[model samples]
Target: MQAAEWRESIRNKKILVLGLAKTGVSVVKHLQALGAIVTVNDFKPLDENKEAQSLIDENNARVVAGSHPVSLLDEDFAFMVKNPGIPYTNPMVVRALEIGLPVYTDVELADKMTDATIIGITGSNGKTTTTSLVGEMLSHASNLEGQSFVGGNIGIPSLDIASQASEADRLILELSSFQLMGASEFKPHIAAITNIYGAHLDYHGSMEEYISAKWRITANQTSEDYLILNADQKSVFGERQTNATIVPFSSTSQQIDGAWYDQATEKFMWHEEVVLDRRDLLLPGNHNVENMLVTMAVGKLLGVSNEDIKAGLAQFHGVKHRLQFVAEIDGRRFYNDSKATNNDATITALDSFMGPNDRVVWLAGGLDRGNTIDELGAHMDKVHAMVLSGESAEKFQALGQAKGITAIAKAEWIEDAVQKALDLSNEGDIILLSPASASWDQYPNFENRGDRYIKAIEALANPDSL
Candidate 1:
């Protein structure tokens, strides 16, 4: 459908809002503000509804809680404003599309509302960290008028922020697969696809479809835009289908043209002129070093000075939920890495901090994405014991059994997993939650999973015993 036709059809029309989550609530508010009759739908009961009620009552949108049936949809509604978490292949969504109901996403709405320069970051992993770092770096370098806020897949509603963000001369956006699917014309001045690995396989159906979604960051880029990529990841840098000037960064080699790693001082050498020291990066990881290189290359492309880049790198405190330290007790360090939902991320988390002799009780498992956990075989020797939970618990147990290692893989819940981990942990040991699977099986998202893990660890490690 043409953009104008799509817009007019939804203009002041009845709309069905699916998934009353953060993004869903924001979409309801935006659509209602434009005088559309909105009805919020979810799989839970509406009675005593807390978050949904506040958003619905304020916007005068009706709430149909407790299961999503096609009957809940009013024929008068022109389109379905889908939450990114909901699959495009969902029976309800597919049926809606079949009936000529236009399915629009939050990104599509945000794209229509903003006129500011956008920098969207997408990948199978590292989107949140990279987006946050980019925003921080821009803040240090940019003397431009207006404000800059980072949001999209990371957190917050960019459209809502854009409407109120006067000081935002630029917006740093973290786009996800669902957000990118309906982004339509969402392009960024500086776009990067950090890395692609097997992820959200259930939602994507195939690896090819998943890769296509990540590339959506560069979907609408013109000749004037910058497309920075992880030179280490062939899934991104090796793609010859793109039109933007391919700037690459890698920790492995300095052979890439634009940004390459210096093995001596561990600095990111760019254009044979600028260098950003890896030591200056606050986030401690070889993965983060790669993340920093990508951001600095983008900064260099924008003519951001060395001092500003350094200042930005220093000020960046690192993203929460990715190896975020919760607390330590009895000399045991507990880390909440609920964000490590893929194989690469979990492996990076283990390699970043685990010591050779440290009794590492690794908490893993969740819905199996058909990912090859064999990739984690190298770190398997590093980890002392594995505590498995969620759908893939047995698979992990089998892996440990086959390898003849110590592991506990019977947890039905996060707390069970924590207790199992604690039972296996000793003084000077580290407890890490680096589940290599999506969190949707047991929690709202990875943040919820991480928060629960941190809370459970806090209860286990009582310092008042001091």
Candidate 2:
């Protein structure tokens, strides 16, 4: 639908905005501006909902903030706009579904409100780095300068940028499984899945449900659209069924058609043409090389020159909290991979920096999401010591003991974990904070956990400063 038509359809319609999170606020503001009769609902009490109260005052919209009253559902509402974080099991959402009212996320609303070409990216890992790279590559391309907007799960909400985009613009979005779950008509012109692994099973309930949510990225895509995937990931390639043109990228195999990392030559190749040397990339690790391949494939499809792609990949560093270098103290290097919220992600982090003589003082453990750490057993030989914390610390200690890791210590907090890792590390050793679980047991999110880790490291480096 065109932007004007979407605006016309929402004028004066009774729309219910569920949850007053960041995305929820954006939805209420956008709908109100379009002449929709908006009613906001959130579980937080009115005294604690300053944002919702402000929105009500500014937009003149009705709000039921104290609780999710079922009486609100009795009103003849046209449809519901749900926050991505609000689960499908929410009582109000369940009621809305039973009544046959259409439920949507801000992502779907953004899709209907814009005519720009969309590039949707989703995966268990590497979504942020790939999304940021795509944004930078498009920015450097002389043809695409001032014509690309990158946002979604990476930070800025897509709904806030959709109205400002023109038909010639490119919307680069990093979509999460939660946002994708409520998406019905969000068909991106170019969609890609970095890779899928067992993650968010606590919310998704099963591995099958988690995989299905990721596949929704290409559900509405047609043959004219493009779907970039990791050819090395059997779970992604073997299970994918889509009408979109499949563009496979790999760091392991060269038999694929779209893009491949030629390990023999250490070059990134697209259709047998070498685009850039592996040594030129600023980002480290084989996983990052795979991310570059995905970005290069998208650039190639958009007619971006090989030179431009090489330049973008060379200049781009990486996103924070994913194998980020903290600081070197007393000959020991500290790296933060706090974004490793699952076993698969931690495995990738471990693979990134393990050598014959190197020793890693690994810090891990958090909200156990029911995924096993058996995969890390094969790589345990590289670890010098294990420092565990959070709710799953004891479980991790037992797992380490079973793998024959001799030096293991358990801490009650992240600060203590950092100190424990420091005590166990020797000169020339590496201390890595790659928690293979969620941080909800302590910090609100992974970013907060990573920031706390950085702060603790700084304090440890200067003991007398405090």
Candidate 3:
């Protein structure tokens, strides 16, 4: 169906929007504009929810704040729009599903509203960085100017850009497992799973369920579409089944038909064609090399020139809050990797600085997402000292002790953790904030947590007395 027909179908339909997060608010506005009777339910009280208050004041729809009353599900609602963060275990959601009401996220709505060529990217680690690099590479492609829209889980609601996109445009989305769980018909022309590791188990309830959710990105794809896989990650390609054309990219395996790094010549090869040399990439880490390989493969499929691909890789510095350089003090380098909200991500960050001279004064810990810190034990030797913070601090400290890591300290807050890391660091040490947990314990999100870490570093650089 076309956009207009889809919009007309929802007219006068009763749509219950659960949660008042950014995506939920966008859904409310979009549905209201489509002439639907929108009712919003959020756990936050009206006084605490600015989004709810604004909608209530505007009289756009009925707003129920402070609680997700089960009675709301009793209403004659046609379907429900859910915020990704609201798990299926929520009483209202569970009841809604029990009653046969279809659930949808903003991603599904975006897909229904546009005919754009969507390129969906997802994984445990590297989603943001790979998505950002794909966007940059496409932006530099002369043929794709004014024809690429980038957003989704990377901080922008896809619905915000879906309406503006045309059939000629390409929508690049950074999809999360939560968003994918509620998606049904949201298929991309090109879908890429950067690499999967155990993550979001608290919300997903199990590793199998988490992997299943990640695989949903390709559920709607067909043979005409392309599904990118990580050949280096054996688990990623082991048991996965997809109808879409599988394009495997690897940092180690040169035998792959898709993109692969040729270690012998220090070049990136795309099916026997040399795309670019490794030395041209500005981003650090082998994980980043894997990301670039995926980006280059996607670019090649889109007919992007080798020159544009090389230029884009050279120009892109990496995403904020993902191993971003904050500042240097007394020859000690600090990096903000607040986006490392899982053990796998923190492990990747730890591996990034594993050289003989690279000693990391690691700052980690945050909201425990029901995952053990034991996986991080393998990388603890790289860390000279660990200054932990937030709800998982004590747990991480215990894990560090078990791993035989000396100089472990726990701080009440991120600022104190930064100071503690600074105190333990010597010249040439790397201070990294790669929390292997979520940020809900002390901040709204990872970006806010990273901003606070950056601010704390700035304050230390120019003390009040100075």
Candidate 4:
């Protein structure tokens, strides 16, 4: 729909926005501009929330703060615009659903405002890297009808991008299961599920629910659209049906009709043509090779040239906090894989850095989600020393001791962990921050934790600091 028609449809409609963050504030601004009567709600007190105060003072928004009172339902809201992170079981949300009021996330709203061809990517991991790679590949394509715009869970709000996006643009979105769960009419022209694994059980309450939420990305797709499925995890999905054409990508098998890595040639095969050689990639890990398979599928479908795809891969060096290389101090190299918030991700990080003789001073631990360290059992051999922190520090310490790691120490938090890790490292050792748990216990998010780690490393590397 055009902006005018969208505005007309929502004009004068009473909408309730749940949870106040940057995205929540954006939702309020857009709705208010469209003449919608928006009631902004957040758990933070009004005095403590600068966003709420500004909304009230600047836009005259109906600000409800300090709680998510179910009583707000008395206002007879037409529907709810919810922050993706807020669970559906929240009292207000549960009550709203009980009354049959429609609830949607800003991603749905963003979809309705733009005519751009959307490439939505989601997975248990590799979402950011694959989305970013596709964006770079398409950006290098000189013949594309549209420019590439990347957003969603990767950082920028989709609404902000959708508002400015034209028909001659492709919005490459990195979606989370949380964001996908709330998206109803948000179908992309091409959708990709990189892979699925057990994750976010706290939010979804179960692995089945988490997988279901991720599967929603393909729910609205038709034969006219394309769906990229990770061939390795085909068994997990088990003959699920979707109207969209399935483009299977694999790192271990040769796909005659889709995208795959040809083990014999050491090349990424896109429908029989070699798009890229694995050795040419700057990013490490087999997980990244899997990511590139998805990217190759998306690039091929979008008509990106092989040369441009190769160029994109050559220049890109992975995203921040996901196996990103920091400065080298003395002979020890530091890597920030702060985005590795789960065991599978951390295992991938460990596998990426493992070599014949390289020892890793592994800095890990964070919010305890009750995940088992069983998967890391075999990989623990590479950990020369372990500096743990956060809520999961004790759990990790126990695991380290169980694995017979001689150098196991706990720190108060990430900064302290970094210092202890530096002290434990040898001249040739790799200092890695690949926390196997979420950062919420000590930091607001993984990005803050990663920034702190980077800052600590930089501070230690300064010559004048001594």
CA lDDT, every model vs. true structure: 0.76, 0.87, 0.88, 0.87
lDDT of 4 by residue, 142-197 (tens): 77886788988888888888878888898899899988885677788899999998
Residue-pair clashes per prediction, in order, are 5, 0, 0, 0
- Candidate 4 clash figure, as a count: 0
Can you give the TM-score per candidate against the true fold? Answer: 0.71, 0.78, 0.77, 0.80
State which candidate has the highest TM-score: 4
**What does the lDDT come to for candidate 4?**
0.87
Top lDDT prediction, candidate number = 3
Q: Rank the candidates by TM-score, best first.
A: 4, 2, 3, 1
Worst lDDT 10-window in candidate 4? 1-10
Give candidate 1 regions above 4 Å deviation: 1-13, 48-51, 65-78, 99-101, 235-240, 325-346, 353-466
User: In candidate 1, how many clashes are counted?
Assistant: 5
| Residue 269 lDDT, candidate 1, scale 0-100 | 82
For candidate 2, the 10 contiguous residues with the lowest summed lDDT are: 231-240
Q: Compared with the true structure, what per-residue lDDT tens digits does model 2 show for residues 312-345?
A: 8887756789887778799988888999898877
Off by over 4 Å in 3: 234-240, 325-347, 355-466
Where does candidate 1 clash, by residue pair? 44-66, 146-167, 146-168, 147-167, 147-168
TM-score of 3: 0.77
Candidate 4 residue pairs that clash: none
Lowest summed-lDDT stretch of 10 residues in model 1? 1-10
